[model samples]
Target chain A: MALAASGPSERGGGDNLLLATFLEKRENLVLFLAARLRSMATAEDLIQDLYLKVAAMEPGADVRAPAALLYRMAANLMVDHVRSAQRASRRDAQWRLETRVTLGSLDVVSEPAADDALVARQRVRLLAEAVAELPPQMGRAFRLHKLEGRSQAETAEAMGVSRKMIEQHISAAVRRLAERLRT
Target chain B: MTQDGLARAQAAAWVVRLGGDATGEDGVEFDAWLQAAPGNRAAYRRALVLWCEFDARAGDVLAELTAVGAQASARPPAARRSASRLVPPAGRRRSALRWLTPIGGFALAAGLALAVLPPTVLKPATSTTYATGRGQHQRVALGDGSVIDLDAETRLRVTIAGSERRVALAEGQAIFDVVHDARRPFLVQAGGRTVRDVGTQFDVRQRAGELTVTVARGRVEVGSDGSGQPVLLGPGQRLQVDRASVSQLSVVDPAETFSWRAGRLVYRAQPLADVVADLNRQFVEQTVIADPELGKLPITGVIVLDNPRAVMTRLSLMLPIKAVPSDRGLTLLRK
Candidate 1:
């Protein structure tokens, strides 16, 4: 009920939507890239890789949809980075054993910095408070879909409601959270 | 809605939709939306940051939240490893959240993000032991097309010969899809119980010396060593054997048991503590709930196995909870 005036508006027009879009959304994309990765360093590396790939593209090479293509390239780079990281981990495992990296223990994953973890801990409280303030149904919908990482369809099925309801609840929950969590 | 409000709403909707299996058009549309206005991207980034935070900390947030009017139950004994999870949660999904074990001290290094190593063995003809790391899953195809999907932190050995097919599931859980060869019986041994595949699809989960077998298709026979008490499980039938060697059979949807291999967790009105127990298995971080009452809250949905930290960030939003660093990965407290 609190989401009637919220959600995407049907509007699309020409506004120089190529490399310009990439520049405008670079910072936004950095947040996105960072979120998808386990560390800011990896995200930064991949974003740089993405820029190179874009710059290296041959000009006037049938670039049908530049903005869409840019985003897709970004996603592709992310996927590739993950695949390489996986391979490196396997190799690292073998390398650690060969070099006698440590004792009998074989824990390879990198640990998060204590300072970063502390900042995250504070942020979790702020976010959780905002979620607790939502309407009951809205809260549940957001929890199941957004927090639990369930699909909207899965959230609908779990709640015994329609997918549309889940979408509306999600939008409302996000709007409320953004408003409340703003510093 | 004001301009900012409208932008946040659209951004939120886009995040949800794009998070799911978005197509090429959605990307084009999203790009157009991004190019249309500058504020839209900032608003979207704000929403995205929160979304990312939740993905990272899913477990801790759940530990923090207290459901409205939920019973503020006392904490189960810390040493009672599986005792907390043994408490069957509310709803028709009685058999749901059968994590069965809530090991608070299930020691894992905190803050480390594990990358799931892909299943190494593609085709196995002889006896080979396949193992997965903590929070890792693998699907192995046998020399014969029979597939065995392994859950997180599992160890199993498989042997295939002309005479018979044998799988020794030493620990963890696996779903077996066997190709019917009447001459060679498919036998799986786990948690002191042997599950004989009478040409069926079934899942066997063994955690902390407790085992559960759920049959999805065809039939399976569960038996203890040297005992005539062989229990038969048909489609939708489940058999659970506890640490005390007590065996119980119940009706359950096999799909739920089969969900983990498919990269998602399916639960219906499962309690928060039990859900956290499941999360603990899939993550290196152990989420400890400060208030035991928070564990009573029911969670109904699927949880995509992203990293644990992001999930915790999101959990804080939906539940009355927050988290702090602890000896064990994270300690969750009420907001």
Candidate 2:
């Protein structure tokens, strides 16, 4: 199948076209990787890895089919990634176990300091109450955006409000709570 | 401390302590506020000391307050004194009550918090959804750049992450023109089995416990999530997986399965019942065959998506069937 290809001139043209096609389809390539990797960022990183592999391939290599070769390389990369992830997870688990003893001692010593903890509890409780007392809309916005860890833009979108409105609500909420808790 | 200095210090403390763990930006702001004035620095130091002191004893106080609050809320006004006995000393009782008042108010504050905070701060990392309303065909370009052409009244969830790309076909049919990425394997979960890609284009259709998968390019491994070697499908190969049995491999035009995405419906010697089922999803009025035997009749043709009435009229002319509008839907019967 490799020998059946036309002369050097035709193969060179095909290689150039294939390289362009690969570059043009980078987004599609990332999607393909993301679907398997389950993370878009990871997929993007893999695409870079794929590009480097493709770029390093020897020039004027007799290629029976370019698209098939591309797919073959991609398949091989996935197998290698899965093997490495398994090793990393195993190492992480071991590290967690090793550090547990040192961390445990710090926790034990901290437990005896009770008065400081009581005051902190009072402050948190006060803050929580102040938040709960806010108007329903303002309260929800604050909880989802502040406590729950959503972005201001995402919170606005979810609540069907503008980002500016979200910002205003948060500022007002903070001001009101600060005033109430001052006493 | 001067009143203004104390006020600024308190505000900074609230912003930090009540801000729910300090973020990087918060740290920067705190530093800036401290350096803003010498008095500000002194006030913050005092506030920080108070905050640290509070943190050390908060848990035990919170536990005690929780029990007292629950008791206070549960009992009648007459039973209130009984709950108060649970309170420790005079100072402890006053502090506990002070804590309870605010804690009770926190539930109200939670609602305010949602409105105030940024959505990204609370949103989960990712969520997947697949939806198709009546007579609607939708296409979704996933975050990964893969496009899913959903058949009418279909639903599916695409879950793409760094480690795996997965699509769960909850219902209906879809054509996937997958891009090959070797670092991540694309797998589609449909019906009772999963179809794992080998750099391929494919169509998976699931209806009433019957599932069919057709591959256009590369290879697909079709197997139940539980056991058995998956049936491998090369280009132009089709396989059916179901609870009762897996069908033998067959050569078929994979394009025919995907034609619906182009507003064309192609059927090869299919049962009238099956054709009606497909049409039902595409039209508002349901198509039904009154005669069971007539429903068993075979149908074949390419349906160009015109209006529902036009398509029904054309179907009636091509076959020995009539369309009757009923309360249930459009019924097909032997004419």
Candidate 3:
């Protein structure tokens, strides 16, 4: 809890003003990046990068709002990270396609252990059953969006319903299924 | 609805939001919701695991669903496109598939869901087992910043639940540095007795059906439910239980019991056999007293456990004894 509040004082006494300020708002930065990146692990990595960049930065800069500058740098880092990840995924997809004919979907599905496979299948069957037992419209929306590959907007258009209505249907359907499967 | 039920419903709503065209604001709100309560995070984690599992098995589940649908109704062509898109032709395969899309947006939340979920869905907890071999000392650092220093020949199983942090000391000893959480009590069950700590540092040792609890900081309650009234122990207090029932409380310097963490065995007028028993745990080669008379000899002073043979040599100098090297261990006899 005191990770941020005490971090600045513990690290830099007075000389490193930027480092102190960064440390002071470190926890806030983590939260902000956590929201933006959607992955806390990636957000943490980005924060570490931000800390390094800030520590090595020139002490005196004509900067207004250090927090804003910090966030701007973090956002740019995230963008770069996302772009690189996308490029990597594209390459990985290309490789998979090239090798697919010989491999024959071998690596596509991970082989769960024998005992675990049975249990997982049973659980999956229960989930499918729960989905089927939902109200017809709600079930259809869930099947189209969640079970199938359709986005909420696409599912809405296919079902001839508003996107908002589809979203409501999905949330309700998921709630019902989770409750049923949990017991 | 119960609080847990509400939390589950909220988690379901968040899952749908994450699945759909979720805005940055929605991500922020979800993060806040996750951090709001431990139960919320637990419920969300449960939901996410199922969500991801379904995503992983989307193809198989869809094939089954389609089969079931065809068996029930004749209208299968209209629903076929959406399901078929999940597994497109090799050339037209989407780089960002179903698994990547949902997981990427909710990646931070997905990691927590990997821990084991017990049968009790309402109070989700992850169980971890920690053990140390002879002459091995280990420090188990928990996610909550609590540190458990396991002594030689120790076996501890920790179950961190929403309501409590529970540990079962099946054998040997461990020093627990419990994180302060008043809402969740840190409890250790050993030798048919339970030791509950309220934000404290304590050492619990259970060897051959005998239990001893020494508190270094804060307070601890030692008892079993419906057995008798539990005794409260504060700093410098120790409680010893024998034969799984009788409890004797005494004043002791907690440092003497906790010194094992520093690799020093400090004893004050303890039996030679008891001292040898502890040494056996700390060394590969065991030490056995040849005669019962020698076993009851009082041992006092510090025994540094850098080397087992050196410890035996030191024991020989301190007492009038001869250390006879045997096939199994060193046998001590009167010189």
Candidate 4:
């Protein structure tokens, strides 16, 4: 049950290569799926389905380039989900937006220091301030992806920028936010 | 970059890279980097914590962005320049829908001026601030025939220039009936998001880190501030952007959303916590759910914005709950 082993050095990168690649990109794949599917919860579900797909792979399956195959598989799974989910979601478009996707179980409330309501509010204020402080382009990028839950591709499309640019902006945004909130 | 900055940047890059491309060489490289230095792992952990926080509180962050963005943009130049650094891309076309949501059934909050809607009266540029205290509602009529109904404990700033009609909802809820003057489009710059009217009537409510926009008439476009794909909401459609998360579209009865102006809060299948938060704003005395699980109870009824005691008494009969006197106000306990 070793979910991941370091690179190809550990036991000649045989059976675990695909699983390792899948494990490494699991979080990123969620983003990739979320952007296309417009739902984090669904993306998570797909990631699980992907894990099963990878886990069930023959141990001796001589697969060349596991990463590309893994992503392609994820993309295909996403298409399947989207095709099926479209009719059901649209027909029942009576849902609200409080769907809390526990990405890695980000237990922010577990912090002992900010236990009080006031401290939590102040922390939000700080976060908002840092985000608001970002330049318009970067700020919009952060809002659309982080705040609005748009995929980097969708965000790029919305901002009329390249997907690479959206990624860069998000990276920069995370860097800037971390720096500002460090204190 | 400084040593710490280098680590932070690398950490951010790894986190972001994983979001886009974490497989193949990228994954191996990241693994090597982590093992290469102790500081690298620490840096990555630090960035991850922050990233996770953003993911967890995405809704709150967005709402706060709107609430904070409203105030940041409205602050005097001295404060504004230091905060945002760059100005709003004024270069972006200001062509907006002048349709501010109108309070069709409510009177003016300031003074009962003209009961008749004002014609398209061109006026000198001015900025006006309208706010409501607890247990108070105000209807504000702008010169452009557009009307806004301010709910309790709401504050908004209205600035009408020769070219644009902008309202920043710092906090609270407001229904807008904007007049269709294409020349001066009505744009509501909330926190970090903008609800631009498309010759439509809509309600924009920003609370905590969540924003709910329900379009009652015509259509409105809700987008993150400055730029991004604006979500077009049509009549009887509601878009709820919960703290930096998903912009959930739902079929809602517009009457339920707009009923607040008529002195009754209409809710259909909303959580009891959401209902209580709304009540707390309307009344001086607050209602606290002693049981966190009790807050998740679905409430579907109309609550008159009268005294808290009367409202609670009526609510208790409808639901299995009892109100006990507490220091802050009344705590709702299971019967």
Give the winner by lDDT: 4
C-alpha-based local distance difference test score of model 1 = 0.63
Residues B1-335 of candidate 3: C-alpha lDDT, one tens digit per residue: 89888898887777777654344444445555766777887787566656655555543454344333322321112323453422223222122122211222111111111111111111226897877787666655454435566777889888888788889999999887765666778899988888998777788999988899998778899887557888899998999988847788899756567656544576766778899999888777887889988877777655555455656776766566779899888999988
Error of 2 at B62 (Å): 70
lDDT of 2 by residue, B183-205 (tens): 66789998878999876668899
Candidate 3 chain A weakest lDDT stretch, 10 residues? A92-101
- For all predicted structures, in order, the TM-scores are 0.44, 0.41, 0.41, 0.42
lDDT of residue A126 for candidate 3? 70
For each of the candidates, the C-alpha root-mean-square deviation to the true structure, in angstroms, is 20.5, 28.2, 25.4, 17.8
The candidate maximizing DockQ is: 4
- What TM-score does candidate 3 reach? 0.41
lDDT of 2 at B124: 18
Q: Model 2 — TM-score against the truth?
A: 0.41
In model 3, where do residues sit more than 4 Å from their true spots?
A1-183, B1-124
Candidate 4 local lDDT, A1-183, one digit each (tens): 333433443334446778767777676566555533445677789999999999998765665666566767887776676667643442112111232211122312233343574586678778877887887778878876775455678778767899989988988998899888886
Top candidate by TM-score: 1
**lDDT tens digits by residue: candidate 2, A1-183:** 243332121333454544543565455454333323434565577778878877777655665544445544554565566457633321111111111111211321223256765575566667566665677667656655654335567678767899878866765555455456555
Report how far residue B177 has shifted in candidate 4, in Å. Answer: 1.0
How badly does each model clash, as a count of residue pairs? 20, 76, 0, 25
Q: What is the DockQ of each candidate?
A: 0.10, 0.01, 0.08, 0.15
